[model samples]
Structures are given as structure tokens and as C-alpha cells.
Target: MESLNKNQLALLTCVIALSFSETAQASATALSPSSPGTPYSQLSNKVMAISNERIDKQLNQEINKVNDVMATRVLAKIGDFSSY
Candidate 1:
């Protein structure tokens, strides 16, 4: 079960990284060379902000799953082992 959880988390990380890269590339290209203070090759701050938000969200989700498993084990220990 722990290995499965690790695999799932790894897969999720890969997917998120892939998608964020694509989005950042697209946004970078969308900005024009002559567009005011913006550089053409520069990535948008919004893209970075969103990517950070996604990473934090994923981390929090994984952390919650781990916490849940710990809580279940703690409960089992506190209660009856015969039931487990």
C-alpha cells in the first residue's frame, strides 16, 4: 500500500510538471517583444504563481493522505488490536 501510494504520488507529480511546463511555454511565447515592459521570452508571473499553487496543493493532498494513514494506525493501537 505504501509503494502504491508512492507510485501514485510520483505519477501525479510528473503530470503536473508536464502540464505546467506546457502552460509556461505557451504563456512565454504569447508575450510580444514590443509589448511595453514585458520581454518576449519572459514567463508570466501568473504562470509561476499558478504553478506554485498547484505544487503546494499536491503536497498538501499527499500530506493529508499520509496523516490519514497515521491516524488510522494510531486509532487501531488505541482501541482493540483484535478487531484489526
Candidate 2:
């Protein structure tokens, strides 16, 4: 095998060091108490709450739309100039 040039050697050393550092960090994180499940549960609850609020908002919007349509139809039927 050909000997590596100085720059290539330096680059290879940096890559290996970074790989080991990443592995060590991953191991450290895995050993911590914060697992994925707890955060997922919290996130799921938040999503559900947001979804419910959006649904309620949509229902209110539909109700208002219907009310406006009915009001316009009533106004069209009563076409006199001054009865207020």
C-alpha cells in the first residue's frame, strides 16, 4: 500500500477521531434516563389538544358561515327601503 501524504493522514486522523467521539456521545445519551417514550407521550397529548382546538375552531367557522347565509337570504326577501 502507498504511504499516505501528510494532509491525507491528517484528514484520516480527524475522521477517525470524530467517529469515536460520536460513538461515545451516542453511548452516553443512551445511558441517560430520558428515553424516547416519555417525550413521545407528551408530544402526542399536545398534538391531540391542538387537533381538538382546530376542530372546534372549524365548527365555529361553519356555524358563522351558515348564519351569514341565512341573514343575507332574509335581507333579500325583505326588499323595502325603510322599515327599521
Q: Which candidate tops TM-score?
A: 1
Please give me the total number of clashing residue pairs in predicted model 1: 0
What's the TM-score of every candidate structure?
A: 0.51, 0.43
lDDT of 2 by residue, 1-84 (tens): 143255445655555555555545554555456665657566556555555555455556655765687688779768654565
Best by lDDT: 1
lDDT of each: 0.70, 0.57
- What digit string (tens of lDDT, one per residue) describes model 1 on residues 1-84? 788688777867776876677667756655646566865345467666666776677667767776888799889887887677
* Per-prediction tally of clashes: 0, 0
List ranges where model 2 is wrong by over 4 Å.
Answer: 1-41, 80-84
Candidate 2 matches the true fold with a TM-score of 0.43
Clash pairs (backbone) in predicted model 1:
none
Task: State in Å the error of residue 12, model 2.
Answer: 62
